[model samples]
Target: MRQFYVYILAKHRHGALYVGVTNDLIRRVHEHREGLAPGFTKRYGVKLLVYFEQHATAATAIQREKTMKRWPRAWKIRTIERTNPTWADLYEEICR
Candidate 1:
C-alpha cells in the first residue's frame, strides 16, 4: 500500500513554519534541506522536519496540511512540541 504524509518544517524552534503534504516524505524533506524545493520553505530556510504524520491517501494528507497551515502560530507550535518538545531535526531519524 502507498502512503502520504502531512509534515511541518521549521527554521528552528518556534521559528518560521511550513506545512506540506507529499507521498515521498524522505525525498521531499531532502529537497527542502538542500534548498532544491524552491519557494516559501527554501526562501525562509525552513528545513528542519519538526513533525509529520502518515495518511492512507493523498487527499487526507493534503487536507491535513491545509488545516495545519491555517492554524494559529501558537497552535502549530503546541502541536509540534507535543511530539517534538526539543524541535530536533527529524531528517536523520526518518532516514534511519
Candidate 2:
C-alpha cells in the first residue's frame, strides 16, 4: 500500500498557514519552498513545514487535509505546537 501525507506550511512563526496533501511530501514541499507551486503558498510565502500527518492512502490524507483547512487558526497552532513547540522548519528533517 502506498502512503500519503497531509502537511501544513507557514510563512513564519504564527504566520499564514497552508494545508495540503501529497504523495511526495518532499517534492511538494520543495516546490512550495522554491515558489514553484503557484497560488496561495507562493503568494503568501508559506514555505515552512511546521506540521504533518501520514496516512495509508491518498484519499485519507486528502480528507484530513480538508478537515484541517476548516480548523480554526488557533486550533492548528496548538496542533503544531503539541508536536513542534518551536514550529521549526521540517524540510531538513524530512530530507533526512
lDDT of every model, 2 decimals? 0.94, 0.94
Residue-by-residue lDDT tens digits, candidate 2, 1-96: 688999999999999999999999999999999999999999988999999889998788888998999999999999999999999999999999
**lDDT string, candidate 1, 2-40, tens digits:** 999999999998889999999999999999999999899
Q: Report the Cα RMSD per candidate.
A: 0.6, 0.7
Let me know the TM-score candidate 1 reaches against the reference structure: 0.97
Worst 10 residues of 2 by lDDT: 57-66
Shift of residue 12 alpha carbon in model 2, Å: 0.7
- What lDDT score goes with residue 3 in model 2? 81
In model 2, the clashing pairs are none
